[model samples]
Target: MVMTKRQIFVVFMVLVLLVALVCASHVTINEEEEADRILQLPGQPKVSFQQYSGYVTVNHVAGRALFYWLTEADHNPLSKPLVIWLNGGPGCSSVAYGASEEIGPFRINNTASGLYYNKFSWNTVANLLFLETPAGVGFSYSNQSSDLFNSGDRRTAKDSLEFLLRWLDRFPRYNQREVYITGESYAGHYVPQLAKEIMMYNKHSKHPINLKGIMVGNAVTDNYYDNLGTVTYWWSHAMISDKTYRQLINTCDFTHQKESNECDSVYSYAMDQEFGNIDQYNIYAPPCNKSDGSKATRQTMRLPHRPHQTFRQMSGYDPCTEKYAEIYYNRPDVQKALHANITKIPYKWTACSEVLNRNWKDTDVSILPIYREMIAGGLRIWVFSGDVDSVVPVTATRYSLAQLKLETKIPWYPWYVKKQVGGWTEVYEGLTFATVRGAGHEVPLFKPRAALLLFKSFIRGEPLPKS
Candidate 1:
């Protein structure tokens, strides 16, 4: 039907108003992002890339907020994918380990006096987003005191999803960007759970997250297999005697909700008497010398009745590196620059929260079920283990993956980087398994170049270099 001149003018006016509204919305989101941008971090060297950090309130009623640092890709950031990284402790800060020491661009110096550029930072290939998740870890916090003690896997995943949805709203430019979730240790639980939440949300939401895949290193998968694998790794690597191994196997019932006294005795004896002073996270690396005199005591000690508690605390490369993060992040200037701790949190910033770790209310005994679900859902899944990690050792990952009973797609073979063998990889029907040679629990810290190569391959959906 033909419109009258007046009707046409009204339609034109509505179109003009819609365009104006879109422009205004875009400008507001950009302004919010700019407000959160990092002008300059106190000891950092000038660089070409942009960075932004701030908090996204996940639970307004609970006054819970999570902190995040986004290091944009070094070049052509708009063309790159966004990768979110988390570190597992049930309570570790991604800023402390993943950002400062592993895949992020800056490395904190020994004295915490300065920062240096890492040539192998993962930001080269994607925009790296590091999140200090769940309230009470790192700069993340809650006004409600009980939130700290009540956190667990389910709550953590829910809060992370809320954070991402809110964060995407604040940075609308990245609303449709392809996203990948990566982490280690307990993040094995975090990454998949968050992805599942996103997948489920996408089915009903107006704007769905473009989640591509996930990769986890030295992950905590199954309690029974991980515990069995840890004991076997220690024995095979000669960290403990054959007799001690047999004793642990006989007494430890990983399936039991509680640790038997006999199991505790054997485990403690194995660590204190049998295992030497070497770092369990990286058996070949020397223990942290700069650690407070308590390192030895803490290393040998195991928390009672908590599955994976001992290993969770021990997951790091330079044991004292966390000390540096503590020093750097706790600086008042650093807090001001990152726009963190605006609430004047009462406690000092720590790498991991003991309260959360100790009181975490629920943990899935096995993540394999989620793995099968994700794999069947057509998500790209890659699991890598650092061979030298005695805590959640390669053996543990192998045992856990074996339970999936997947058909092999590619025979096991060495994958190379820079003319040297970086790792061994074997592809299954839907999952990929790889081992980083001579690497520890924190693989990137131990083998940055290889880690970057692996990340590139994962993002490109290419196999690791066979040459």
Candidate 2:
């Protein structure tokens, strides 16, 4: 049937847009850009920027490799710096938690059947690289089988450096680019150690990483302070009874390398009082169960491997994100599109790896010295906290920073985002600190706009917006 002039014009415009979209989405990874290119994600929306997902082999002997997802900047491809993100469980997938849940370009739609654009994606300003590190975490794995048992802070740093060097070899254009290490939770350990390794790498090379800065959100800087702050936060927030609180302080040793039986008992009592029904990660968040007794259950990937830790707590406001991501990633089409699980690893993909967490070799190392060293080297360091987090609360971070005893360059003050107070901030001689007022452990997931403002400020080396 022949169409009218108006119909023809509309159809022509539609075809033009489709053509433009194909052109925009068809980002050619130059011949030098190695690894698998993402044709498209299963439920992705039409986007202008390109995304690549695949693995980088860090160890040839152990057949060890790490998975990464790279999302290029929205506008400038060549001019933007690369920011690498890691999420810490000592065993978490940066792609699942950081990329999909927090700051990536697309967030899983509520139905888990499609995608939606994140208004506050970190990719607005720079290229974002999310890595699932230490082999055996997320889609990253090792063929040699013995790798997981040896997982430790030092080993993770070494492998991460190796992965970076090899990955940079593939994307050679980023050689002259300034790279920043950014992560949260245990990445408090990962970021500083990796940066230290990069610093060492720079000493031996002419064309180095051009390492610029680091931004950590609610990071675990010191064990003693972190532990002390947790119990203190619980008591102050009225989550625990005064009796249990007093007993915890009197009987428990927060700084103990390994908690004694007595200490564990006291802590267990405290936890029983407050954490049974509430989400420990975010104290105020609702549990899987309710007073009405309706259950909001999460599904698991439950790979054939020995059961370890539950891959929970990545979601911020959405209580069911763990279930959603598990379902989305497990789809066969999604895996093929992303070039994932080609090796047919024995287990289903999980957001957090229990095996890695159980095998984690170092938990007592205080990273305060790493901070001191970074500060002394004139690196741009910033630490922000999500005020409502119980896992690694803002109080813990403040106490950890206090251990630094750095000279104060600026006193504490409220910082704003879009005329609203985002949180408070304080700047030391070599570091800047800020907090997200009402956010939980996963700040960006809960407060995207404020988190983006915080990130933009961090990336620009400016203070958090103070209007």
Give the TM-scores of the predictions, in the order they appear.
Answer: 0.93, 0.88
Q: How far does residue 159 in candidate 2 sit from its true spot (Å)? A: 0.4
Q: What 10-residue stretch in candidate 1 is worst by lDDT?
A: 296-305
Cα error, candidate 2, residue 424 (Å): 0.3
Candidate 1 achieves a global lDDT of 0.86
Q: In candidate 2, which residue ranges exceed 4 Å CA deviation?
A: 1-29, 32-35, 288-316
Residue-by-residue lDDT tens digits, candidate 2, 127-205 = 9999999898889999988787769889899999999998887787788998999999889989999999999898899
Name the candidate that leads on lDDT. 1
In candidate 2, position 115 carries an lDDT of: 80
Q: Write the per-residue lDDT of candidate 1 for residues 1-467, one digit (tens) a residue.
A: 99999999999999999999999988998898998999999899999999999999999999999999999999999999999999887788999889998999999988998788999999999999999988998999999999998898899999999999999999877989999999998898889889888888988998889998999999988889888888889999999998998888888897654688888888778877987777777787666554455443122212112343222223343456667788999999999999999999999998888888777788878889999888978889999999998878898899999999999999999999899999999999998899999888889988999999999999998889999
The weakest ten consecutive residues by lDDT in model 2 span 301-310
Residue 394 lDDT, candidate 1, scale 0-100:
92
